[model samples]
Target: MEKSGLAEFKVEIVESCLVQPCLPDSPRSTLYLSNLDNQPLVRMAFNTLLVYEACENVLPHPAKTIREALSKVLVYYYPLAGRLRKKEDGKLQVECTGEGVLFVEAMVDNSLSVLGDLDQLKPSFKQLLFRFPFDNALEDVHPMVLQVNHFTCGGFVVAVSFNHCVCDGRGVSHFLKSLGEMVRGHVKPSLEPIWDRELLKPRNILVHDLVSNEEKIECKPHSWTPPVYKESIQMSLILDFETLKYVKDGIMPKCFDICTTFEIVAALIWQARTKVLEIPHTESVSISFAVDVRRSFSPPLPNGYNGNCIVAACAKAIVQDVITQPLSYLVNIIKKTKMSLTNKYIRSIIDTDQFPLDVHSNQANIILTDWRWLGFSDVDFGSGSPVNICPMHWNENGINASNGFIFLHSPERKDNGIKVIMWMPSQEFNLFEIEIESIIRKYVIKGSKF
Candidate 1:
């Protein structure tokens, strides 16, 4: 095995296949992709890592069981087996030919001890963890791929790669849970996947008469490739309850008794990330975050609707304005931005098929995505619950490593607050860490009744 600058290991590929439904369940008709599903997912694969401790040794015959379960699950999620092809109009749709999903199995020479904490998946470590061995060029056609890596210490990691066009983080969790159910001897999934794109299809006529031109959505059609920050690194930070409560109380309005957790956390991150970068005070910077539109729409999306029902909410400010503002000031901005993500705005964007609009953000143009309720903990494949589940960004498309993007998620084992995993320029990371810690510490001191 040729080794790079990162740790070296001999990876042996045990098996590879295009897994299809054991029983024949072909799509009666071609599936037309929905507007929400037609987003960036089509261009790249969203990868994830689930690590489990080596308590039981079931390596004897987990293969046939796993394959059979995947086949059963595939019967319901058939689009995974279909091909995404562009139509005459240049829009993409799925040709449900039941070609099947790519599945790979490999064995690593090392153990979890050598791997340490997987919370922050560095690029070098990511090389061993990525699901598909091939490059991003194959993602558009191969919508889903899987890899199971067995470590020498008996611990194993399940890596999955699926197209972003098919679904968002919630949908990925749903698909994985289905696989887990099948792996645990259930013939059918707990929640059946719904694939009717017409549910979100735009009406032929303009529906809103009272809406003004100001609220109209903008369409930006341009090919964006993910940015590559070769010099940047990923860092994970845990926000405890005391830190969160202090910050939230500091930001909460006097008249208001409470505020959302996201508002306070987002505000702190926005300010800290921007300050650490030491951007010019006059420069305009924006932050991009995603808001789920499933329940936000007039009629809620189906419970099992697996598609990209998310929109970006962006907020911008001059660098000086952000750095000088009080924590409450920034928190209010984030709250107001979220409040603006109304059903009206969501419908407008859906009807126009426009790009996601910026909502609440940190300058230096950092992007933060919330995945607290994605339910990765429930994804147990015959073994006990996973010790850690880290998401790998869709770096192939427009999600570059140097973009200062981060993910905020609930702790792996039920802690009060959230954790952040982000990638940024390595040079500023030390100061960035200090800035964030002190931000909370300052709030904690201020919130004292004294």
Candidate 2:
């Protein structure tokens, strides 16, 4: 049975087919992916949701225009139309088959209001995105897939799923911007697509080992099995600029250099989460995140360079120290670890044979990533910019066992501050909330709430 009121909704697919490139003579050869792209951490596919509200001028052809625009955009991002194949050495490469991507046209049973607030959403997998009919290996999968679901109120949602071997967050954002330009009647993308994947290949130099041995053992890139839990929930922590300013100002006097918003917030969460978990005092706790290395290059890679250009940045401390020390201590540790990611550090990780995946299976670890400045808000297809953009949490058959924190930039809804989305076991959520609130009150003000 469906939920009552605005929450009751359903999606039905009206059409599904392949959307090929408009150009006939796309490149027909194999393309080598970088070590960063081939690493075990980003070996799977991920999905993102872009929500658009009703617009009188663009209501009639929401799916038609996007389908046409995708065809044109694929001409430039040709690799996305191809498939991935694993080489003899176990590294994956693009086959450049130009087979095309899956595009689905769907319709919703109700208006956009049926979904309620996008900023604070629960997990729902009612076929908003296209799922492959048959199970297949990564090589047999389509490089990219998209679904556009039209609502009764003239609003629609664009859900995209793509393999990580082709591009990272920045690279995909660039592609969406180009596609949006095409939807608005631009013949060509504003920026030409660049596939210089070879530039990110590791140099033939001795690898610099920065991470500790404990991290290597814990974060080793191997097949992962999701841990079974009684129940889990998704929660959001909204910190506007004013709240952030107050928190940072209260703590800056005790730190070395002024800590960044990410650094401070990440540290706060790590502390709060660890306290709630009740881990042993002697055990080690780790926080891992991706650091963009695009600018770290001597001659920076062009804005259009579409490939993985980030490396794992990890910081670790004992549980006792983390729980007992001041928040500024963890902030300093994160700052130092992130600052250590120089061009040399990036090259060393790439050049090495075994680059460890930062996400450890250990229960005491925290994985955080920042998607606040990926240029998603600027993407306007014909109606206008999307009213909301967020990662869709789907747990069909428990295939998606992602347990981590994502930092989102909600300028309109969050008063130009940041929103942190967290997934964790329900049993500990109340305690975690209490811990976070206490920390905020202790540091920011007597009665402030996060």
Candidate 3:
């Protein structure tokens, strides 16, 4: 059993296999990866999505069933099986020789109940259940890797890691749902992926205002695990739809603006996070959030065309400016930033041909990720809906702790509010909760004043 301060569980790898696509595109050719696929962090950031499926009657044997299904799903996703290679012009492309995905079979000699609630898993607890266990060698550079953990009580966990450059969250969903279809004995994936990277290639002459060379946001290295520990001290706050409407209503009259849930959430959390950092009032605070450009394309990225179709937008202002001004003030900044993410903005980002890095604002910087209603609950791998679907928390060491971030989770079926996952030093835990709740409470008690 591997142990951390939080929990203990024994994980043993049963087998490792390279599951290639059942059929590669005829007359193998190198796939041209577009600029959307060439972002620097795309290869650097390994996205880990953990799916906790509860106990089921006569659970399917995972090793045999999953491997068979995954093989079939890869038929359409064969590019993932190939390794990422750099071309002569410094662009990244898929070598499509169909080397295959690294699939691991593992067993957890424990039950899901013992793991407790899926939402509150700490780093140590997470490490135990989902093991990719690669040594960071050149050989370990895979576009995708999956680990299936079978529990003693018949429930299981699935962890999928993918290079952000090759695909985005939505693409992962398409692939997984396809795998599920195969596991359930379907002949084909319900959603067939359309791979036409040529369609997304950038223009000959680039034009973008937000991410030009001189205006770019500077980035710095920080700890993924802030000085704070992601223990039970890490908790969640639920802002129901009703409360959201109330809060939006409150901000409207005071800030004189209509606000979406995302704008409201980002504005609220940005100020609260700034306060937590305890930076000087005059210090500048920044907040950046991801925008999906799937619909921004002229004809739109084909249905199920999930690659890295994102460009980050940010609002930067002095700490006092963000907090003391009406909530509308901060909301406007965020809204303007979003508005700037036009098709030209994305084209300018692609023109950079590097990670369109969000320039880091030194103090109390926050990255808000909205993952609500992504429809992961609909992905059933032979069982019904998963009890929980969580991305690995950003608490790992070396992701700048100073610049705070939030990944907003989808509201559960039984719940009307959003669930958020955040990581920072445990010492600031109380301060953050108080700040967020205080804002929510103020609006709760005193209705929006016209």
- Index of the highest-TM-score prediction: 2
Instruction: Name the best candidate (by lDDT).
Output: 2
Span of 10 residues, lowest total lDDT, candidate 3: 212-221
Q: For candidate 2, lDDT tens digit of each residue in 238-303?
A: 667777677787778778897999998898889998888777676777898888888998778887
- Per candidate, the number of residue pairs that clash is 10, 0, 17
lDDT of 1 at 162: 78
lDDT of 2: 0.77
lDDT of 1 by residue, 6-118 (tens): 35556677888888877775675577877777754234567787877787634344444666778889989988887777777667777777888877777888886655555
Which portions of model 2 show Cα errors greater than 4 Å?
Answer: 1-6, 119-126, 133-135, 206-228, 393-396, 399-402, 411-415, 446-450
Q: Give per-model TM-scores.
A: 0.86, 0.91, 0.86
Against the true structure, candidate 1 has what lDDT?
0.69
lDDT for model 3, on a 0 to 1 scale? 0.67
| Model 1: how far residue 13 lies from native, Å | 0.8
lDDT of 3 by residue, 93-166 (tens): 77777888889888876776556544454544554433334446334588888888887877787778777777
